[model samples]
Target: MSFLGLIGCDNGRNIRSICKNNPEICADLHKDSWCLAEKTKIIQNRYAVKDSEVTTGKQLYIQLTDLEDYSRCIELASGVQHIIHTERTADRARAFRLSTENLSVLQEQTRERQDPFMSYYQWTRFGDTDALNRFLELENTGEVSDPFLLAQAATYYSNRNAIKAQQLYLKVFAEIPFDDFDVNWLLGLASTYRQTQQFDKTYMLTKANLLLTQQKYSEQKMLALLGGNKLLAAELDLKAQTLIDSLEDASYPLSLVKIWLESQAVAADIKPETLPVHSDEK
Candidate 1:
């Protein structure tokens, strides 16, 4: 059967429904072969594909972001060499609108300036694991000088790749410093250090972060970090024992560590109320 004939014969109703709901799909069929391929998948998968072609920079921008396939999105983005600098002001405006709209479609109503990093940032924030991983590769290779990007990359890698995440966090901390930096990144870096068995660094960073911000710290996680540090534990073992002793009921990690320390009670020589509670302690 012919293409249009086959639509009516078997999948015609499905195609009709998609085309009716998304006129852009119909519009792109004549202009963009890639758009047609994506639209065909929507038909075959019974998922909705966006309308529009890739004739102008604006259309290309929409097409890039509209696709769920990360590789295709990157391919489409690469096809448009300089989308922000399109000769037509309307094209440039449309590109900016599409990119920023993806960031926050409802709240960011104001037409903001074209951000070169917006697409990458959006991919990093909202994309699936594969997309995030791909974006991480791009982030590693690119000259990502922006502190926000570095922090975001670090956060994304915080669980997946502790070494890379710690390195990125250290870079962010060193460049921006705590007094002017995002507290979340500091805590994240501390957590990364904790995960990688860098107890001293974790304690130092966590203590510094507590001093900088009044945000709640997880007592269990902190105690676990301190408990693993032989140097700190040797000097402050009595202090930790005293803190738990003062508390009527302690939580898991703290309780667990306290129990273990109690088993070593003779060796610990625990002191009473010796641990210094900080202003930030919960």
Candidate 2:
């Protein structure tokens, strides 16, 4: 609602200036005392929403989550006592109260909405089965294309359905830019590969994530993962680098990396499987 319009009227100003100039925006918020990090993010995202005349569902979803984050943070910050500055704590408590209510209002307004991003929020926040179904239906119809949502659904299947998780993870990589995505998706694919005994693939994906994140690993453990086959390890590392290069260059949707991963699955006789039949199917 117009509560989000705090930034709708401002043109160009620093965050503090925006708040100081627009009493409507910062009146209910704590005055630069607590939850500063979350507060900054909330204001920034609201500014983004206000600046975008055509606010996508993703932007709204982000605003919802940012408010949620600020609410939770301030809720904790509201508990401390300040003998000399008693009003600071009171201010935080008020901010917490307002943020919590705003978040609830926002959620209520978006509940039962058909957008995949909003459905994701409803499903996660309320465990709404219908929201989940709507999300998956949109996904199946090729409307759920955001990389974050896709990776999350891939993760949702990881523990219950290895093949399905693997497919979804690959789809994420195939569809989004490398830098725009989290390396954790790479680790998700690695875990899926391991679950199905595709050891080579497991190592390759894990290596790719490690390489991209610049995370260090144990040489002994790494060597053992490949059973001391230095040549094969080198080859897989090369493949991983090639995959990263392709993604960085926007060379996907039919990238050689996808072809390589799929060919390996075929070579191993791994058949694609839908999610394991479960209560989720209902």
lDDT of 1 by residue, 1-282 (tens): 233453554454656666677565443232222344444544433232232232332333334444344234434543554556544334333434443444354223212312324435345444545445555666777656666667878897898898888778656644553344675664687567556565544555555555455556555455555554456645454443342233323242244433432231222322222122334555
Q: TM-scores of all models? A: 0.39, 0.76
Give the Å shift of residue 136 in candidate 1: 1.7
Cα lDDT tens digits, model 2, 1-282, are 443454454433445766765656666678845777788777766655555668678988988988988998998899988789898888888899999889888888887577889989889989999988888888778888888898888898898898888878888887876667887787888778767777667767878887887775655455555666778779989988887887788785667778877654522433322211112121
Best by TM-score: 2
Clashing residue pairs in candidate 1 (N, C-alpha, C atoms within 3 angstroms)? 7-12, 24-51, 24-52, 25-51
